[model samples]
Structures are given as structure tokens and as C-alpha cells.
Target: MTDDKSKRDFRDRNRVAGDEEYEVGYFASKFGLSIPQVRELIARHGNDREALEREAKALGVR
Candidate 1:
């Protein structure tokens, strides 16, 4: 029997990966904010996905 765990989508959606440039870029685009803004949110919120999202919304996505 072969283990097919590699096919699983193991990404943790509850946390933002600050070190991943693509992840940060995607998050920024999703909120219509700049990469720097998302990065700053990650830094302040410690990558908590919901917190960053709330902060991003409070900042007013444009």
C-alpha cells in the first residue's frame, strides 16, 4: 500500500505565512491593499489570519 499524503492540501488557513512572498501578495490583492500593508499587519498581529483580516478591513481596502 502506498501513502498518498502528498496529495493533501495541508496549508493552515488560520494563520498567514509571513515569510511566503506569494502568500503575502495574494493576501494583499484579496484585500486590495499593498504588500507592505499586509506585511505590517502580519507583523503586528503575529500572522493570525482573522486578526490581520480585521485590521486590513479597518484600514479600508482600496
Candidate 2:
């Protein structure tokens, strides 16, 4: 469990570029949400790259 958590953590700080556009799933893992939950939240009170970085700073995900 711990390892899975950390593995996702590792994925967050440095986002995967090119092919894999950094997604809500990435943020969800960082924030302990289910993928569907993350997608839903994004759908609710929207934010993309700039907002996502702002959120990450607030949450201190890195």
C-alpha cells in the first residue's frame, strides 16, 4: 500500500509529457482520490494547467 502511494507520488512532481498528458488520475493518486472522483471534481469546479499547479502548491503535492 505504502509503495503504491509513493509510486504515484514519484509520478506527480515530474509530470509525464509528450504522449501522456498529465491528467486528473495523476492528481487523484497524489491526493488519494479514486480516478472517477478526480474526473468528477475537475468537471465540477474547473481548472486546467495553471489552476492545477496552483492546487498542487496549495496541497503541497510534491
Candidate 3:
């Protein structure tokens, strides 16, 4: 369902490879989410860590 452009956008925005805060396991644990869930969050939320955390909290996650 995801297009290549969207995949590129996710990667470019999230920058997870070198950013420890955005790493799958770390982000997932921080938000009490699975890795895939974290990835989906990043994709949907444009990879802003603070914003994602706020959104998660607002959504009653954890």
C-alpha cells in the first residue's frame, strides 16, 4: 500500500539509521509500542520525536 516516494519521505524525515532516539527498539520501548507500530507512527507523524510522543500521549498510549 505504500509507494516508493512515501517510503523515501519516511526515511528522509525519520533519519532512523544514525539517530539513536529514532531507532526502532528505542522508540518502540519509549512509547510502549512494537517496532512496526513505531515505524507506522513515524510514517504518519513525520518523524518528529517530540510531536510523536505528544500525539501518543494524547492518544492515551502508555
> Order of candidates by lDDT, top first?
1, 3, 2
By TM-score rank, best first, the candidates go: 1, 3, 2
Q: How large is the C-alpha RMSD of every model relative to the true structure?
A: 5.6, 9.7, 8.1
Supply every candidate's count of residue pairs whose N, Cα or C atoms clash at under 3 angstroms: 0, 0, 0
Q: After TM-score superposition, what is the CA distance of residue 50 in candidate 3 from its true location, in Å?
A: 1.0
Question: How do all models score by TM-score?
Answer: 0.77, 0.40, 0.54
Top candidate, metric TM-score: 1
lDDT of 2 at 37: 53
lDDT of 2 by residue, 13-47 (tens): 44322223255557767767566655554554465
Give the lowest summed-lDDT range of ten residues in model 3. 13-22
Highest lDDT against the true fold, candidate:
1
Residue 59 displacement (Å), model 2: 12
**Shift of residue 46 alpha carbon in model 3, Å:** 0.6
List candidate 1 stretches off by more than 4 Å. Answer: 1-11
